[model samples]
Target: MPISRSFRCSVFIGVSLDGFIARRDGDLHWLTSRGEAAGSDLGYEEFIAGIDAVVMGRGTYEPGRSYDPWPHEGRHCAVLSSTLPPDADPRVTVHRDLGTLLRELEERGTKSVYVDGGQVIRTFLREGLIDELTITTVPVLIGTGLPLFGPTGGDMPLVHLATRVFGAGVVQSSYAVDRTT
Candidate 1:
């Protein structure tokens, strides 16, 4: 299925001013610095409230899956992975392909989905499935760490929608997808 067939999907992430999402050791301490306005979540709460479902990468969902209290209590959550045990909760469906997963979500009347996790977001963006992106750039930079985006096959130019200063040094910019390449 073509990416356009899906109802809608967006990516929201926070990166350092230099484009690192976490340290080389996967520590997110740089993103938690109060002096750099890292405490702000870049309006993710509002964004999550507006989404009908959330699709995340296996690595991203793994840690949260072991939570004593699952966070996505009432929302449809899909973990993009074929390795997940089948005994997992029925509410959580494991998928191997992004296209197939998207098709299923569309059939289920999912109006919108939140594509989260670094690798997962990159995959969605690379496939031209993301309709919008809301990225918050923190003021600090991690010399070595995971970047918000990696090399993709093509160039994706975005149209600036709006920007907001959340608190202190945290500023989020919203962009619309330029589908007409």
Candidate 2:
């Protein structure tokens, strides 16, 4: 039955209009150089409150885990990597199999899941597992860097939900997934 179950997964990320999430060397210099009042993050607090767990890739871990903030402290965090140590964090778990991970979460009656990281979000989109995507696009553009949406095998459809404008020239858009034919 194709692991039939209803699971709600969301992607909350910041990307440049050209589609890069960060500079080539993983430096978010472009993002940091922007004005202090740039971009609207008004809905972020509410968005975070609606999720039960979060999944992210190695590259995405640094920003969220740095400075002892413990971004996902209260929520279950799944780091998708085969190389990470088994005992990485008390609140975080490493996962290699996406299916197994979702199944486990579903079994626990998890209501919402947040998928972070460019690669991780792409994977969820490709697998038709993501239900919503909320992307904030900054004004600046990085010529060569890590892209938010890499080359996918096919097209995915999305229904526009809402948009928010932040300080400086930042814009945020939200979309609900539409099953692709």
Candidate 3:
């Protein structure tokens, strides 16, 4: 069962109304505070179920490493980092280049990926490698923090696929990358 080379990279994340994924100290308190009303997950389970693997930046992986029990269990996870410490989690492999990482995953039969972390997502977007994005906008706005999108070289057009509003005042939108643009 060889993995197909036609890999689809997608992003599923939540950002504050002002566009910050995490607070100044890398805290996601504002986002997590509104925990899925009644374990709803706000469609995260559906999105993640379609992904074969997860890729994130070193900054994102480090924090999860400290969790009592790792968050992404039973999934092939890769961290993009050149300076990843030697004690990094055994469950994850470190890589320096995004292209090479995707190629390796594709060769392993990975068809879809969930691209995560602020820096990793921005880099993938800038490279025009992202295929789809499902961004959930949390109502509360944090004045300052890390933004989800930084300046890419040029404008990247996205085609709206769907939109949903949750009872928690959260708005989730899905978009397909307009590669032809």
The model with the greatest TM-score is 3
Single out the weakest 10-residue window by summed lDDT for candidate 1: 32-41
> Candidate 3: lDDT of 167?
67
Sort order, TM-score high to low: 3, 2, 1
Q: Residue 49 lDDT in model 1? A: 89
Give TM-scores for every candidate, taking all chains together and pairing residue i with residue i.
Answer: 0.88, 0.90, 0.91
For residues 34-111, could you state the per-residue lDDT of candidate 2 as single tens digits? 524673444778999999889888778756666477777778888887677758766677777877778778877888
Write the number of the candidate with greater lDDT, choosing between 1 and 3: 3
> Cα RMSD (Å) per model?
2.3, 2.1, 3.4
For each candidate in the order shown, give its overall lDDT on alpha carbons.
0.80, 0.79, 0.84
Sliding window of 10 residues with minimal summed lDDT for model 3:
1-10
Which wins on TM-score, candidate 2 or candidate 3? 3
- Count of steric clashes across candidates, in order: 0, 4, 1
